[model samples]
Target: MGLRSHEQLVVCVGVMFLLTVCITAFFFLPSGGADLYFREENTVHVRDAFIREELRRKEQEELRKKAEEAIPIPIPKPEIGAADDAEGRRIFVKQMIKFSWDGYRKYAWGENELRPNSRSGHSSSIFGYGKTGATIIDAIDTLYIVGLKEEYKDAREWISHFDFKEAAKGDLSVFETNIRFTGGLLSAYALTGDKMFLKKAEEVATVLLPAFDTPSGIPYSLIDLQTGRAKTYSWASGKAILSEYGSIQLEFDYLSNLTGNPVFAEKANKIRDVLTSMEKPEGLYPIYISMDNPPRWGQHLFSMGAMADSWYEYLLKQWISTGKTDDRTKREYEEAMFAMEKRMLFKSEPSNLWYFAKMNGNRVEHSFEHLACFCGGMAVLHSMNEPNRTISEHYLTLGKEIGHTCHESYSRSTTGIGPESFQFTSSIEAKTERRQDSYYILRPEVVETWFYLWRATKDEKYRQWAWDHVQNLEKYAKVNFFEPFLNSSPSYFQGAAGYSGIRNVYDSAPEQDDVQQSFLFAELFKYLYLIFSDDSVLSLDQWVFNTEAHPFRIRRP
Candidate 1:
């Protein structure tokens, strides 16, 4: 019995040992295996999260570096008057810009232009086919300068998705696209330090490069942005206009500098070399030049009004753009000014109003275009660089006289707005007799001159003249909400009203031309803002304005 009891106790002990082993296996071994698997999986996820964070941090640092590099040199703000009305004037201009932009946003939106009278959008041939957002591109810098943050942000977003390749249709004007798009983009980059604008500018400029594929390296007036095939306008007699090709250097050169690309500078410099090498008739460039292997002048026409205006303006501006180091450009500009003073510059009979007349051979046309009014500002700008006090004083005098004459053209008009073209005849001082020359297309040249004159001389008259022009524009050019019935149904026009061109600046009740040019935003409003603000806003010392009034940073030596 004792033996059986001992065997029973041993069996019980064995069973207890087996149960303990089972519990250890179930609770410890499987849990260890599961922990190993989960630890490995968690490590991978943590590594992935860490890598993503590192990449995001690196991207942010790169953007910060780019912004630092793009910041403009510190400019000392000028001391304004103690009780200056400049702020008041600036506010007025800002409101005008906002008004114009609001109208465009509501009615035109992505289209090239605004039909203010009709309260609709109109795409012109110059902006290619369809809606290219030309107005938006042109006004982006203006919006930024005026501190319209919301409007500026909207513009930037639209530009981020803008596809130039798709925007291309039919033929695009190389000059127009360069000045309004590429120039505008470059200006925005200079102002905002945003790389998106630089990218877009380079893209558009690449598309435009093929236009300079001619034997003489002279760019065609018009180019198919898609096909890259280029040709001159039929009206130009298969020759490129001087203003079209010559005016592109500022944009291209600025682009080349920004991107560190030699190609753009080479193309632009080639145009300059050709112009500098060519023999000028009476030291004045013709309005048209052929695109031949050895280019030839097209016509004997020389005018500072239309075909030949910006070319001369660019010569001086290019010098300033390159840190005033391009002595050749300066010399060429001086020679042209001397020749113009001798040949084209004249004074009207009784009023003695100074004007730059058109020259066909040796004969003077005795006519002035509102477009040529920009020459007054050009003269004022150049006078600052002239070393000779006598010549500088003469340029200043000429600039003031030109500014005065342009103001007279506006003040003498029945509507207090200048005509497209006016004559300096024995009887007529600044009146357009021809019906074709009677319209005013919201031009900024006259006021552009006033802005320059105001900056240079600080004469209250210049500001007053600009204010007068603005008042006239508001009274006559601003499209009235009641005018929707002039073209479309009132229900179709539900947005803000925009400024329209007057059929006749001389007519008290002139017909609306129903078009708002992109330049109204790019040039007129911009100039108005600059003239009213302190010179430090976009000081002439640190910046050079393109022909389109888009300011670019001057390369400092």
Candidate 2:
């Protein structure tokens, strides 16, 4: 019995010794059992706890960064006041007149563009040209004889210098010259007692009227100025903006009004019809289209920029002027604008400055803001006759915000217009890592925005902003290139310049014409300043007109 008990005890002791050996190998061995045992016994729980705390802290930090980067935006409602419709109409007409006159004639106009072909390869002042037409139309429609005289003289001189034969098509100058000189002349004659501006305008109009001969019903971008025939297929839908197509229609209207010919209005309607057929299923207009056929997304490159908005403006204007009140085309145009406002025109930075963009469905393309676009919005607002309280207020705020942001961003000592320099990139999550390319242009757009804001708000800050723009232009952006005729005499100046910047950072080099157009930029602020500073001399008659002749609805949600 004692021997059996000892054997049992020895067996139990052997099992216990094996178990200890196995435990040792598992805890201490670098591979297999030892490593696994060590990890499970000594490190897993403690390491996991530390990791959990670290991850939580990291998450909190990320949240804080996101909060810091967010900028607040205001979405105000537009309010309409007492039968200010008449007053609003007068304000818009006058403002348009003043803006067109002051911005172009006082600063730019015959300055940057010397004698048509003599332009310093950079005289594509779309606003300057477009506004000239606007000035003529406003003067004629409002029956301002004195205004017509100044405008007609400028119109005639502008046309006298240009043959329009060698102008570049697909280039903006062709359209500008055609609109301003051609359309301006016709409108001037139609309104006042001057036939010189009118006769010359008719000749130019006859030259430009053939640009609408494309299969797509859209006008070709480039027309042989001499022959007045279109030759290219660029940005078909881009003309939808009133500024783009408006001058053309206005010209046609001028022709029709003067000659008592309905054919001009008929031609204008053809453009309207063409754009109506090109609307997307969602009503978003493409940035560009083929001048030869129906618009396709393949031809949709560069669709929604500042120029594109002008197309919309003109379309709506056409519908109203032709008594297309119940027209589906007019309604679609209105709807598209609403989409543009909701999706694209937003203040991404704390400054409340508006940015132009392409919308991909519900998303606003908060990529960049161009000068022409800011002006486009202001022009649209003026035309819509919406009370200046909200719509105008928003644009005015945007201008102020943009002015603040631009002064802050381009504060460096650099010459030449910063091509695509004045952009708000806070909305871009990967903006820091992105490179500046074609889309990132720094040009006259920033200062142009300042001009628009200053004009609209009449705030002293805008004048200060304009002064800052001028200081920058004088300090770093000045260029002294001589004209071909007088190489030593320096015959040309650039108000608005090129699309590229130094080292290709975010802008382009300074251009003579582009830089001179900045003078036009200066002229706007100066005029506004003079008007407000010494109101006794300036006439509001030049600025105000009735819009009841062409009434249209201005709605908001």
Clash number for candidate 1: 0
* Model 2 bad stretches (over 4 Å): 1-174, 184-193, 225-229, 234-247, 290-307, 313-333, 346-353, 359-365, 372-380, 387-456, 478-557
lDDT of 1 by residue, 179-272 (tens): 9999999999999999999999999999988888999999998889767788999888899898988998888988988999989989989999
* Winning candidate number (TM-score): 1
RMSD vs true structure, all candidates: 19.2, 24.3
Q: Count clashes in each candidate, considering only residues at least 3 apart in sequence or on different chains.
A: 0, 48
Quickly count the clashes in candidate 2: 48
lDDT of 2 by residue, 53-120 (tens): 99977865655445435522111212222113323322332333343343344333434332111223
Model 1 stretches astray by more than 4 angstroms? 1-84, 482-495
Error of 2 at 557 (Å): 28
What's the CA error at residue 496 for candidate 2, in Å?
18
